[model samples]
Target: MADPTPAEVQSYIEAGLPCQSLSVEGDGRHFFATIVSAEFEGLTRIKRHQRVYAALGERMREQIHALSMKTLTPAEHGATQ
Candidate 1:
């Protein structure tokens, strides 16, 4: 299969997980995601990453090779503003 586009990856995550806001950028094999959601509240960094990985499911191993993410709750995302 051809590598997935950033949009495809973004849509996949959005479909599987609940997000308040999300943006993804990448060059097929590697991706960077800035994800904001209520689901991230009170979770540790590792847990937050795990949640994203869970959202990706088998594609994380089978298709996507590398993913770097910034996961945050809405409040956290707001604080940066």
Candidate 2:
């Protein structure tokens, strides 16, 4: 079977985060995900990312080779955009 694509991972995470925008890229092995979520508010970077990783569950350790993430709260994203 083929490995899950970055978009697939992104969709999974997005489903879990909800009310967020996500950008994802991968070489079918390593992946980078930028997730913006209201749920990230007041959370530290590590905690925000941990939430994303938790959404991935065991796939993060088993199928996913690498995941680099940038998590931002809605306000934080709005300021930059």
Candidate 3:
């Protein structure tokens, strides 16, 4: 009945991707997350995003309606402006 704040989403994502930088936006129902993690190094973009979704667990289906994610490796993030 209440919107999950951006900080809340950021916290969840951070827990999933330690040592990473994250930017998350959510309307409590839909969320957009941008994450940079070294853990994503060898993983495909789909797999990397799946990992973040997994971190959200049932919330993804039950509470969260949609998640638009952009996951990048640390190096990739650093390369970007």
Candidate 4:
């Protein structure tokens, strides 16, 4: 299978998860994503990452080689602004 582009990965995440803001960058192998969602509220760092992994679903195993992510709630995202 061909490596998914950053946009395809981003779209997959968007389709599977509800994100207030999401951005992804990759080199066709490794990917980094900054994801903001209300769903992340009150979750631990590991849980937040788990949520993202769940969003990626089968792609995580079959296509994406690695995904490093910054998961945040909308409030946390706003704090950065």
lDDT of 3 by residue, 1-81 (tens): 565777887887777667468898878777888888888999998899888988888777766777898999989999996
Which runs in model 2 stand beyond 4 Å of their true positions? none
Candidate 1, residue 45: Cα displacement in angstroms equals 0.5
TM-score of 3: 0.87
TM-score of 4: 0.97
Sorting all predicted structures by lDDT, with the top scorer first, yields 1, 4, 2, 3
Candidate 1 collision pairs: none
Residue-wise C-alpha lDDT for candidate 1, range 1-81, written one tens digit per residue: 789999999998998899999999999999999999899888999999999999999999988999999999999999998
Summing lDDT over every window of 10 consecutive residues in candidate 2, give the lowest-scoring window.
Answer: 11-20
Candidate 3 deviant stretches above 4 angstroms: none
Which of 1 and 3 is ahead in TM-score?
1
Off-target runs (Cα >4 Å) in candidate 4 are: none
Error of 4 at 45 (Å): 0.7
- Name the weakest run of 10 consecutive residues (lDDT summed) in model 4: 50-59
Instruction: Give the C-alpha lDDT of model 1.
Output: 0.95
Tell me the lDDT of candidate 2: 0.85
Per-residue C-alpha lDDT of model 2 across residues 1-81, encoded as one tens digit per residue? 478898888887977787468999999879998888889888999998889888889888788888998888888889899
The per-candidate count of clashes, in order, stands at 0, 0, 0, 0
